[model samples]
Target: MRSLSLLLFTFLCTCVPAQTIAQTVDTLMEYTAPSATITAYGNEPGIGTAAPVALLQQEELTRYDKSSLLSGLNRVPGVRFEERATASYRIAIRGASLRAPFGVRNTQVYWNGIPFGEPGGDVPLSFLDAVNTDRVQIIKGPSGGFYGPGTAGTLLMNTESIHQEGLFKLAPRYANASITTGSYGFLRADATIQRTKEAGTYNQFRIGYQRTDGYRDHSGMDRLTLQYTSTFRGQKSGAKTALHALYTKLDYELPGGLNPEQYADNPRQARPGSADKNASIHYHNLLLGLTDERSLGSWKLESALYTTGFYFDHPFNFDYKREANLGAGGRFALRRLLRDDLALALGVESRLQYRNGQNFTNPDGTRPGDLNFSDEIFSRQGLAFGQLTYTPGAWDFHLGLSSSQLDYSVDRTFSAEGVTGETEFTANRPVSVRLAAGRTFDFGYLYLSRTDGFSPPTLDEFRTNEGGLNVDLDPEIGTNYEVGFSTSVAGKFFPSISVFHFALDEAITSFSDDRGTQLFRNAGKTRQQGIELAASWRAISTTDKAIGLSFYTSYTYYNFTYLELERGGTDFSGQDIPGAVPHTLNVEVGIDLRNGLRLDLFHNYTDAIPLNDANDVFADSFHLLRAKLSYPFKSFNVFVAGANLLDQRMSFGNDLNPQFGRRYFQPAPGRNWQVGMSWTAAPKR
Candidate 1:
């Protein structure tokens, strides 16, 4: 690790000194947009509505980890992460990660208006490099009514727009190159170039590489990515079009979880069979999309086309599997303003997926011993929805209906070399309506809403232990009621609070069968209620703006329980839901010094969580403290950051449902540090 860091430093030092560009000074304000105004008042009017949302920009996240998503997104309220190892992350928005054993579920993700998550509702986050995104908008709510069937929330990420840098009067092009190195054998390099023509055309491209010899045995990771974005004015006035391409190649070693005693004895040890089994994952993913929006008189139109594909090879202790997937989807919406106070929107979308995969037996955990199962799966989804929004003076009202259907079919071609072909088909149709009303105050806004959401099982969730299909599982449905209010004081303090209650019918939970094969079942009904609050106050500052200080905090409290449930005729009523995140608190302080130097301190705390439906096993609570320092000179910059400065010995992520050995802990690095340098050619100050 030390050698790699030294080499990276030498290379960056030799390159950055000669390339610095001129720039300006900067600081942050508490609030900019005081009222609820649709970002789409100009385009894509129906895609995202006004709600309790969070926006983070490059300026705020520039110093964080360039390869990890949790670094920046964790600052937002009601967001948390679990990591099985380096480059592996599971994120939950508003405690929506109930049954997601891996990756992000119950959330939708978009890149430049293109739905990458689509109807499958699984976010490809590990494939995304944090530095590639210049802006992120997090919409926290039941997203089924607007962004497909995601019951938790939605994320929109986009590259920087050159026009926003004062392109009209100044330079129309800029480029930057950066190098970063850190503890645990980390090394990264990235280059971004952008150009904008005077005729309203935009183009940007980025390429990055990351490698790390992780803290634990058999946990190394490496990734490479390339992304390009283009935007231009359409032939019609008030119309714009955008095209985006993002490609990633990633591979990571998987060190399975550790038991409690094993964790305490040797925190840096890998799972028992991890090294011998050579467990790991290698994958390639690509996203291509085009988005167009236009305005014709009082009506606005939005449309998008996207195609995504991935191929992966996963080798574990018991199975060697390979899979390939290809999917295509598009969305269309037409919204019109009624008179001056009312607006109506209608939309429809379709998505199709074709997949081919196979599982092979692994006795020695090296090569394929024999064909265990081979299958082909396909799914088709259709959605149609409409919404009516009315603003009568200070009051805002919205009502919407969302209806969707999916058809899934599977064909098993081979199993154990002796099994005959088997086939199964499933069709699911789910519907829901959403209603909301809010009033604007001089300080902020007050809102209340009732919504319904639906989520269907994914292909992996539908596969049976015998490698055929689980034809009995049903879609999980939820009904939500929430009230929220937000306010800002003197442009220095901002506060928001919300309370919510919900009942999830046919809640889908998971358990292992007698043969130790994982399975999914509709466990029964669950009830959840929660309160969340986020506030920020300028603890200290100066009139000259040379030095400033601010403090921000977010807190959440929730009670999620199984209201009614039965397993093997044993009534497990009123049991705490497994993996339910009950309490979380985050506090941050920002300090800025003159001459473009800054310091930030962050502290996060989470309560212990139940790890099983039986509620006896638990993952212990943990606290983390992190810090970052940065200084900018001209267009050249340097940053240093450290994580887990307190050296907390605990799991960063854990398995909610595990085998009998209590192997749930995925230990985090004790203390890690990173240093980076960058040089840029940017618009004139």
Candidate 2:
């Protein structure tokens, strides 16, 4: 705590009196969208938004090493990204990891305006290559009134360039390629090519491959990705259309968590019996999407359709599983100006999926011995939403409403006893509502909002890997209230502050049974509140001389606790929320010199985290330091990066509420280094 305070004070003292610069550089790093093209609301500027939102452009994204988004996303006040192993990712937005045993849930995700993720609420982020992403927009707090049924907010990712329309600013044709190598036997290569025709047609293609030996035993990963995006404006129809396609083949080894003793002895070793089982995952995925926008007289229409197909082959210490899935979804919306100062919009979205899975006993961890169970599952979810936005003078008002429903059925074809009939679980229809008001001032924007939402159980929580089915689990319902303000001081210092309180009923959390099966159950109630502060400063800027210095810092404070909870005859009321760290801070400094040379230094400090609902175990706090340097020539750039400069021993993703004090630690790599070079070819302006 003392060190954290000292660092914060030093950073503030160094940034306060810096000379102001032009708005161009500051806008690129952090700024409100000047238009609604990249957001969900109507066509308006940031003053019209009444909720907290974070936008990261390409320049801000490349400040990291480009290996993973963990460090980059941590810059966001209330967002947390964790990795249990190589390519095994999890995300929590303004919430704890109680329900997210693996993957992302509770939050809604979109790619290029098309709905992404499985119908069952699991987002496979591992399939995405961060290098291809051009921008990311995060809407904080509950946003089901516009995005569907979710309590943890929304994430919109744009892989295509923002300069795809209007006059062409870049060369008609361009190509870029890069390769990187790092410690722990990490290797990566990727290339991209783009072409634009005089007839208003643009196309881009990208391919990437990555492999790593990993830091722990039996933890290795390999992946191949291919993506294509095309956009064009109709010559006579006066309409625009975009097509997107993505494919990935991923393979990763899973080194099971370590117990306290094993961690103290050798944190690099695999869990007991994991070697005999050869635990790993193999996945193949393909996704296709299309988006179209056109004018219907005085109204505007936008629609999106997408399909996804994937196969999963996984082996664990207890069982081996094979699964296949196919899903499709689409969204349609229409917007119009009822009056000069008022606008209305309506949309509908639906998704359906079918999955077939078979589990087998793994005697040697490498091969299946006998089939334990075979089952099939079908899931469907849909939502209808409408919103009204009124902007009159300096006051902005927004109201949104939505109705959502979810249902799923499971049929067991074969089990230990015999064939079983189908079992169904249908959730009650829920209505979500949001109301917001904002006031814009010459110095800044101030806003407040209220949101009510519900999140249904995901397929992974309903059916465990051990073939156990749970139908009694209920959806989590919650209400959130937030207020925030952001401002810029002389185009040199940008700062923002947000405060929120969320109350939830029937909170969903996970637990492990004695047989190693992870399951979900509804806890009683919870009260969560937090404060977020973020600031960015351009300490010195001299574009003419090509010398610049900048600093960014974010701080988060969580005061979350259980209101009412009882499990297994033990009272757990009033305990701090497990997996919810009380405090987190991130600081980054960038230095730019002459001749396109740059350096970035980062520091991250995380408070101790409770590892169980009972509050009997906790993971100690730790500090992480990283640095990167780059130098550019005419057509190519070379860079070097290092992580964990202090060589701190730390656990990144810890398993919460393990059964009978079992393995709960996932240690991160001690130290690593990376070197890479990139080349680009383009026509002169």
Candidate 3:
């Protein structure tokens, strides 16, 4: 790949003059809140609630961890990341496409508040592990409809909390580790532990493990994860409380494909002993939460409650399934600012869900063996919302209103040799409505904006895939438009630009016949538009002279068209719209070398896609490069890194699952390396 694109353009030209002098002294000591703010009304932390874009820091995601989260958020700007192998991965904004694997519809995922897809809205990025995240909020279009209702384009992952004057106070916190051997036997591990004190409380923990023996042929993978957080405080109604937990394990190896001369003699071959193909998966998750805040003189109240659980054992193709889930949700808010530029918010939300399953078949049948049959399901939802904000000066305004309700039910049974059957149902009143807008301006110092939104759909969209039978499908609507601009210039430098348009209506599709079973249909319209650009600079700073420079780049153009389709009875509209991807690009550069040496570089590009929709397999355009180096003594700190260097060979499938060719699958880890260190201890007032 042209020496991995000339060693990532010579490591971003030697780290762009020390990341433009440390982003002009870190934007003059950072801290600049209040630019048309919102954060669910005064719960600080980058102020939330809506109308605030551009916030993705943690040193721009320390070169990513956890098998890379969409290659570090696709370097921002209308993001895009879609990989079906390597434990599957997906993300698309402005032009969504997860190529359906039974889920991923219109993007919608939330962790801190539970509900992370799967009930047909597929969202399974190996269940997260971007070094245990602390921030990642990108809500564009349809104003993310308050976190529910088929997210018109959303990606919100915030985790990292545990405070209480540092609890058992024990300072000296810092540790780092990494070991990667890429290409076809990929392996990874990550670790973190933190503590803080100043009467604000704190504690954070994270651990991750990964394995890969894939490059094709029955692919391979094994994974593990763990996380914990805690916090507590109370002093004159300034109360606070939080607790969180997570656990995971996964195993994989399923290679099913042949014919065409056994895939041109070894696309990394693995067939012959196809014992009913192969597949095995197991998963488990649990979460509990509670939060509260109080104030009177100026009116402020916040409340939250949550409980969630999930278990799974999925054996594909030859069928062998067992699933379980339990859920609970709650939210309440009240805020007031009426005097300072006007502001008001009132909210209510509720959620409940349960599901059970079983499926087995093989006894003389052509695969998918054992267990017989069973099923169960139940669901509920309710929401009431109100919001208003105004600024007067720069014409900053926002308004919102919502009313929602949904209910569902299902049951079934069946036994083979002895013969038995039964099924039941229920579904009712699913409704939705939401809206949003924004505006800002300031020529010289640069800062401009324009926004819009919409979202609707629920009640699992009229059930029927083997439960609560009722396929009267209707629901699923979205609309969004945007325009943006930002600047900083002299204070070192920063730049931004954005443009978008998206549309979806009654869109839900699934197909599988000829006795393969799997059906669900509803299609009519789908659309996506895009544009995004970003920049950051500093060059160098003095205080003993510190060098710095940061860079960012983005590009995305996608289109998925298929106005309508209804087989058998004949009806097909425009066509073209199966895993759409016209172009994608990302660039990164970082350097702080002034003694404690540090350097980072990255590059990625993807174009050409269409392995299905009868577009006849196609996948071209590829580039990747990475590097990292770090050093810091005293408390202990050391590092080294490399990836792909230049071993490009990529291929992804989607037309009825056709993953073949380019033997490396996603191979690029050819130049492997890693080293670790960390030690800290300080707690004595």
Best by TM-score: 2
Per model, state how many residue pairs clash.
Answer: 0, 1, 38
Instruction: Encode model 1's per-residue lDDT on 75-161: one tens digit a residue.
Output: 777777667798888877776355576667777777777776635566768888865777777877575457677567778776766
Predicted structure 3, TM vs. truth: 0.31
Consecutive 10-residue window with the lowest summed lDDT within model 3:
660-669
| Reference-based TM-score of each model | 0.91, 0.93, 0.31
Ranking by TM-score: 2, 1, 3
Local accuracy by lDDT, each model: 0.74, 0.81, 0.54
Instruction: Please provide, for model 2 over 1-685, each residue's C-alpha lDDT reduced to its tens digit, 9 standing for 90 to 100.
Output: 2234234323422332222232222322232322324375544544367888898876666666666677777789999888888888888889788988777888888888888887657888888877667678888878855886778878888885434332134446555667789999998777767678745478888777778899999899888777899988888877889999999888889887887889889989988777678889989999999999999999899999999999999888888999999999999999988998898999998988999999998888767779999888999988898988998998889888898888889999989768688999887546788999989899998999999878888889888887777788888899999999989999999999999999999998987766556778899899999999999999888575568899999999999899999887999999998888899999999999966689999999989999898998888889999999999765568999999999888876877888854777889999899999975554433
Candidate 3 C-alpha lDDT tens digits along 320-390: 66678887777777888787777887777677777777667534323457666665666666666666766
State the number of backbone clashes in model 1.
Answer: 0
Off by over 4 Å in 2: 1-38, 162-170, 544-546, 683-685
